[model samples]
Target: MAIGDILVDVQAVAKHYGDGETRVDALRQVDLQVRAGEVIALLGPSGSGKTTLLNIIGCILDPSSGRVMLDGEPVFDGKWLRSDLRRLRLDKIGFIFQAHNLLPFLTAAENVSLVLDLAGWPADKGKERARELLDYLEVGHRAGVKPALLSGGEAQRVAIARALANRPRIILADEPTAALDSKRAQLVMDLLRKLATEQEASILTVTHDEKIFDRFDRLIHLRDGRLVDE
Candidate 1:
């Protein structure tokens, strides 16, 4: 993809759950976009709808009303535009979470390989791809170790490698550095920026850690489910 191409386009999105007393507005008329090779941080308070917006952009959650475009293709408009959201997510989107969520029984390389395996790659090919990614993320030395044996930061890199295995156009991370210390948090942020730059992938991360704010190219601040000026 071209570096400046719009990879993720969210238009006038709104999301709410329940009704009356139980009503909860998760997002409100939100308009967002992430260009290829750009890294953006989504910031908000506990109930400020950061994750909701991220989920909508990642196609993990449906908005009450909106249009969502992924890699220049409409994937959602009021409802799903594609019947196979799972396939869409796998092919076009990469997801990272607060926890590494790596399989305890699998080695770091195997964890990354599993994603490629599910995408119909041969086991041997998947292993090679995993190694390449681990090497790129500077975690090659720990490729053979299990998640339980790896340090917090090391395990996160494995998780990131898994996310990148498919070479997705968009990468959505939710509190990716929440579990890391200040130094490690900064390291992960730097790695993400590098990934976006070299891979030409749009990166959006939901973060509460203010210490890493300076690491992002742009910041989207949300308050009461609405975008607020920074």
Candidate 2:
């Protein structure tokens, strides 16, 4: 798709748990659109459904009611449109977390290469792709090191590389800078913005880090399970 194309199209999505009296609404009529090359920060207080919305967009969780389109294809309409949700996620979406969830035993490069492996790329080609991502993220020098040996920033960089391994059109990051200091958080947001521009990818970052708020192209506010203007 072109750089200005809408990569994510979420229409009146709602997510609720339990029934009637016991029902708890996590999201209510949430509609969102993320264009390619855009960087947006999703902000909200605790229990405001930020993660729920992100998970729904990532296809990791299903919504109670809504329709979703990714890369111009309908993926969900109350039920998943594609039977192979895993394959859809691998092909179109990337995810990063606050914890920098890297494999304990694998080197940084291996962690990245694993995504390509899952996507059915040849092992050697996967490794080369991992190397390229690590180099682009400026973590190539530490690619052979285990996660335990890296600093928080370094590990998160590795995680970012892993997220980029499949050339995904959209990246959903949940509190990616929560564990970092102010300076590091700012740096990470800057990196994300640069990645969005250079890769022409859409990035929706769920964050409470006011320090890095200015780095985003736009800020999306979530309150009481609904989106609101700043």
Candidate 3:
């Protein structure tokens, strides 16, 4: 894609459940554009279609209409454009959720390294890379600790390290800081902002917290499956 052009594009997208009169509109002609290295926030209340939009952007679900392009490729054209979306997901996207989701059996470093290994990186290199990322995120000291032994904030940081393990082109985080206190939430937001700017990765976050709204480059609000002016 050309520099400054959209790294992500969702044009006239819509999603629905059921059929005929019983249908529920989960998304309504939602049009969105994300540039590389920018952070965008999707804000809304419950049932506002924020998750639907994020799922579509992540290529986890297909839109009922319209199109989606990633890195200038037509990945979604109202249907499953690629047969191996799982591979694409593994290679191009990283996801963080409200919960840390780290395996209880693994150390912080292992959690990150495992993803790299699954992506075909050599074990030695993956371990080295994982260490680098954890250190960069300031969680290096917790590397040998497992989730059960780490604090909530520390586990969340490990989750972020895992998300960055594959060096994805886009990062989609759903309520990443929901479980943290204000101070920790601010720290996570700052880290996301820095990563987006420094790594040139497009980030779209779904969140209810208003405190970090100003940290985003763009904010899109949704209500009842429709876009509202922010």
lDDT of each: 0.91, 0.93, 0.90
Stretches of candidate 1 above 4 Å error? none
Candidate of highest TM-score: 2
**Reference-based TM-score of each model:** 0.97, 0.97, 0.96
lDDT of 1 by residue, 1-230 (tens): 69999999899999999999999999989898889999999988899999899888878888999899999999998889899998898888888989889999999999999999888899999999999999988899999999999988998889999999999989999999999999999999999999998899999999989999999989989999999964
The lDDT leader among the candidates is: 2
**Lowest summed lDDT over 10 consecutive residues: which window, candidate 2?**
221-230
For model 3, the stretches where C-alpha displacement exceeds 4 angstroms are: 1-3
Model 2, clash count? 0
Ordered by TM-score, highest first, the candidates read: 2, 1, 3
